[model samples]
Target chain A: EDQVTQSPEALRLQEGESSSLNCSYTVSGLRGLFWYRQDPGKGPEFLFTLYSAGEEKEKERLKATLTKKESFLHITAPKPEDSATYLCAVLRISEGGSNYKLTFGKGTLLTVNP
Target chain B: GAGVSQSPSNKVTEKGKDVELRCDPISGHTALYWYRQSLGQGLEFLIYFQGNSAPDKSGLPSDRFSAERTGGSVSTLTIQRTQQEDSAVYLCASTSGPSYNEQFFGPGTRLTVL
Candidate 1:
């Protein structure tokens, strides 16, 4: 069974603090790994897509890195406005073919206190 | 340009009732997806439609959940005989194409079943 597990279900940090969120997966064949930020009462917003091992993507204060079995989202100097649930998902190839459906993790709820 | 959009930001209905949620993807996006997010749970894929091809409904939890993409644009997800367990946020997303593309999501519709 394909599973995506995100660690640290909830994290509270002071403004300007940096931390990393982990998303480990066990899948048949990984096609891509995705990161998203979701605010309360809103749908998730796309962040980055890592297609292969050693790939890293960045925007603003967020950086995402991927490996063979897991992915990490590193936040640098996060602010209060950056507080949101960080989600990780994976697309894997199944017996039928490359499945476009995403298997998501139980996102990490990050709270940045000012 | 506008991103994906969903109607009835919130819906409250009694158990055994039926409800329909709607989604309008971005212009020119050929792939549309529907997912459900339960409280404290990961997002679960429900269905996918790409171009004029038949929708992939493998992830749908039960027969009561059905979705349709009309004219390769607007999509609707219908839940029949809703139950208490059916209460969740129904999210819609879209991509230009299927392969490893970042999916843009809409502000989800919060469904409450009493």
Candidate 2:
């Protein structure tokens, strides 16, 4: 069965602190990995998509790197406003040829205290 | 252009009542998706619609849940005989295509069942 797991269900950091969140996956075929940031009372916001191992993508203070079996989201000098739940989803391409659905992991709740 | 948008940002209903949530995909996006998010859980894929092809409804939790996309642009998710357990945030997202893995999400509709 395809499954995605995220670590450290909750993390607290001081303003300006840097940290990394982990997302591990076990799937039939890895099509793509996605990262999203969700704020309270709102839906998730797209962050990055990693398609292959050794791939990396960045936006502002966030950087995402992918490996064969897992991915990491690194936050650099995060501020209080940057606090949000980070979600990771895996796109598993099934043998049936239709692989558009995303399997998401429990997100990492991040709180940046000023 | 504006991103995906969902209507009825908040819905409060009694158990056994039915509700419909709507989603308008981003202009030109070919893939639209529906998901459910409980308080602290990750987004749960509900359905996917791509162009004129048959939708992938494997992610839907039960038969009581149904959705439809008209003109390949706007989608609606209907939950019948809602239960207290059905209370959750319904999120909608859109992407250019399957290869475009990046999905833009809209402000979710929070459903409260009494």
Candidate 3:
């Protein structure tokens, strides 16, 4: 069974504080790993897609790194506007080598206080 | 360009009633997906549609849940005999081609079953 787990269910960080969120996964075959940001009352926004280990992608203050077993979303000097639930998801390759379903973690809620 | 869009930002219905939620994927996008997010739970994959292929309904929780994509553009998710447990945010997303691409999401429809 493919599973995704995210740690630090909730984090409170002061403005300009840097922190990292973790997303661990166990899958038969990993096709891709995705990160998203979701605000209250809204759907998730696309962040990054990591296809292989040792891969990294960045946007503004957000950086995402991937490994064979896990992924990390690092926030650098986050601002109040950066507070949101960070979600991690994985696409697993099925026996037929074709699958579109994404298994997601519970997500990490970050509260950046101004 | 307009991203994926869902109708009826909010829906409130009584138990035993039926409801339909709609999704319009980004123009030219051939793949569409639906997911559910319950309180304190991770996003759950509900369905996937790619081009003219049969949808992947394995993620649907029950037979009461059904979805269809018309013209490979607009999709609708229908839930029959709504239950209190069915209350959650139904999110819609789309991708250009395959699962390896980043999915663009809509604002989601907040479904409340009374």
Candidate 4:
């Protein structure tokens, strides 16, 4: 079974404060790693995809890096609007074929106070 | 719509009632996915539909939970004899194609079971 775990169930940060959220995973054969941001009462928005170790992607205030066992989402000088839940998912190819299904983590809830 | 959309943004029903949540995927997206988000449970994959093939329903928790995608455009998730455990936000997303693609999300439907 594919499993994903995230750290810091809840995080509180002031405006301009930087922080990082961690996501660790264990899967049979990894196809990809994904990051998503979700606001209250809304669906998750895709942020980035890390295909291999030592890979990183940046979007405005969010940056995601991946290693062999875990991925990190770094927020730089975040604003109040950046406060939301961050989710990580992994793609595991099925035993027989490449079935498209993502195993998701419990997510890290981040609150940025202005 | 430019993004995925779900109907009945909020629903409140009795424990034994049946409810159907609807999802409209992006115009040209070929891959659609369903997920559930509960407090502390994070995001759980419920099902996935690609084209006209058999949906990947491995994530569905029970036989009472079922879903269908018609014409490869819109999808509906049905829950029979709703239970308190079924109370959560049902999220839907669509991607252009392939599991590696970025999936766009919809504003989920919040289901509250009494």
Candidate 5:
């Protein structure tokens, strides 16, 4: 069975603090891994997609790195505005062929206190 | 260009009542998806539609849930005989194609069942 798990269900960081959120996955095949930021009462906003191990993508203060079994979202000197639930999802295939559906992990709720 | 959009940002209904949620994909996106998010859970994939091909309804939880995409642009998800457990945020997203992992999400519709 394909599954995604995120650790530290909730994390509180002071402004300018740096931390990392983890997303581990067990799937048949690794197609792609995605990261999203979701604010209160709003849908998730796309962040980055990591397709292969050793691949990394960065945007402003956020950087995402991927491995064979898990992905890490590293926040460098995060601010209050960066406080949001970070979701990790993976795209993999089943016997039916390409599984376009995303198997999402319970998101990591992040709070950056100013 | 406008991103994916969902109608009725909020919907309140009784448990036994039926409801329909709509999604309009981006102008040129070829893949549209529907998902459900509960209070403390991750996004649950509901369905996927790609161009003129048959929708992947494998993720749908039950037979009471159904969806349709017309003209390969707008999609609607209908929940019959809704239950209190059905109260959730319905999110819609779209991507260029199956191989594209980057998906654009809309501000979800918050469904409240009384």
Candidate 6:
């Protein structure tokens, strides 16, 4: 079974503080690693996709890096508006042949206090 | 709508009642997916539909969970005899065609069983 685990179930950061969220995964033939941000009652917003190890992608104050077994989302000098849950997911082939599905982590709840 | 949209953003129901959640994917997109997420858990894949291909129902948790995509456009997820354990946010997403592309997500339907 493909599995994804995120670290530090919750985090509280003062405005301007920087930190990183971790996502570890175990899958058979990784197709992609995805990052999403979800607010209180809204759907998840797509953030980035890292296809290969050593691949990195950045948007505004967030930077995502991936390795063989894990991925990290780095936030720098975040603002209160950046506070939200960060989700990590992986896409891989299912045991059912030619089929694939996304396995997501529980996600890290980020609170950026101004 | 430009992005995926779901109906009945919030639902509160009795444990024995059945519920149907709806999703409208982006026009021209050929892949759609359904997922379930408990309060603090990761997303659990439920089902998937792609263009002209057999729908993948491997992630469905039980026989009570079923989904259908009518005419290759909108999709519906039905959960019968709901249990308290079934309370969660049901999310829907879609991609253009391949499984590797970024999947756009809907706001999700928050289901609460009383």
lDDT of 4 at B49: 91
Candidate 4 residues lying further than 4 Å off, grouped into runs, are none
Candidate 1 local lDDT, A1-114, one digit each (tens): 889999999999999999999999998778899999999988899999999999999999999999999999999999999999999999976567745658999999999999
User: Each candidate's lDDT (Cα)?
Assistant: 0.93, 0.90, 0.93, 0.92, 0.91, 0.93
- lDDT per residue (tens digit) for residues B50-107 in model 6: 9978899988999999999999999999999999999999999999987778889999
User: Can you give the lDDT of residue B101 in candidate 1?
Assistant: 94
Candidate 5 stretches with Cα past 4 Å from truth are none
Please, what are the lDDT tens digits per residue for candidate 2 over residues B1-114? Answer: 898899899999999998999999999999999999997788888898989989888889989999999998999999999999999999999989783468889999999999
lDDT of 4 by residue, B32-81 (tens): 99999898897888998988888889889999999999999999999999
Q: Candidate 4: TM-score?
A: 0.96
Kindly give the stretch of ten consecutive residues in candidate 1 chain B with the minimal lDDT sum: B94-103
Clashes of each: 0, 0, 0, 0, 0, 0
TM-score of chain A as modeled in candidate 4 = 0.97
lDDT of 1 at A45: 93
Give the C-alpha miss distance for residue B58 in model 5, angstroms. 0.7
Residue B31's lDDT within candidate 4 is: 93
**Candidate 2: RMSD to truth:** 1.3
For candidate 4 chain A, which ten residues in a row score worst on lDDT?
A: A92-101
Candidate 5 residue-pair clash tally? 0
By DockQ, is 2 or 5 better?
2
* DockQ values per model: 0.82, 0.71, 0.82, 0.82, 0.69, 0.83
Q: lDDT tens string, model 5, B39-98? A: 889899889888898888888999999999999899999999899999999999998978
> True contacts preserved, each candidate?
0.90, 0.76, 0.83, 0.88, 0.63, 0.83
Q: What DockQ results for candidate 4?
A: 0.82
Error of 1 at B83 (Å): 0.7
